[model samples]
Target: MRDAQITDLPDIREIYNYYVANSTVTFDVDAMTLAAWRSKFYYLGKLGMPFIVAVSPAGQILGYALVSPWKEKRAYRFTVENSIYLGAASTGKGLGRVLLGELITRSKAAGLKEIIAVIADQGADASIKLHRDFGFEEIGRMGKVGYKFDRWLGTVLMQKSLK
Candidate 1:
């Protein structure tokens, strides 16, 4: 895994858009534009958030993991929300686990006190197990909080204390 570069945006968008269109991992309905994606990169860079990408030796982007502020309030400054996405071919290769582990380590080093993962309840057992393996515990569940693909979706909130 390595720090992501601006050049990696296209591949990142591909993976993200795939999940957006076919899975409930992300709540976004529209595929984000390159400019919008660049804006996100800029914003996260400005916020000093960690954005790491897993890559093959041939320079293919396999997956990415990142963390951002959980809330905008000052009191929540030490808390962060994490996201991880794997390229279609890279799933179940232990890459997500490696990326998430690195993310948590870096987050702790950055003085973050907590990391939260908001996961879709459907077909999310792998993510839930991954987070649980990293010591995250289920903290809350919000039923029918999201609507997508003509159905209501539930979200499970899992958190790990970094401090």
Candidate 2:
């Protein structure tokens, strides 16, 4: 895995948009255009967040992991929220673990004190297990807080202390 580049935005968006269209993994209801994806990518970059991607032997991007401010307030500067996405074919192959582990390492090295994972309760079995394996614990859960696909969804917030 390596730091994501401007060129990686399209691949990352493809992975993200799949979830948007096919599952409750994301609540975004609509697919993001390339321009909007670039803006989001630049926003993370401007915030000094880590955005990295995992690639296959042939240099195909398989997945991505990134972190952003947990909250906009100054008090939340040391804590960040994370997101991870993998290609449809990359699931259950340990790529998520590798990508997330690297992201955690990068966050710690950047002097961040905490990493929080806000995961969708539905279709999040792998992410829940992955974060658990890396020592993250569920700190809170909000039920029926999001509405999408004509149904309500919940979120599970897991956190890992980097210090």
Tell me the whole-model lDDT of each prediction, alpha carbons only.
Answer: 0.93, 0.92
How do all models score by TM-score? Answer: 0.97, 0.96
**What is the C-alpha lDDT profile of model 1 across 1-163, one tens digit per residue?**
8888999999999999999999988888899888998998998888778899999999999999999999999999899999999999999999999999999988887888999999999978999999999999999999998899999999999999987
Which pairs clash inside model 1? none
The TM-score, computed over Cα atoms with residue i paired to residue i, of candidate 1 is 0.97
RMSD of 1: 0.8
| Residue-pair clashes per candidate | 0, 0
Q: What is the lDDT of candidate 1?
A: 0.93
**Least accurate 10 contiguous residues by lDDT in model 2:** 40-49
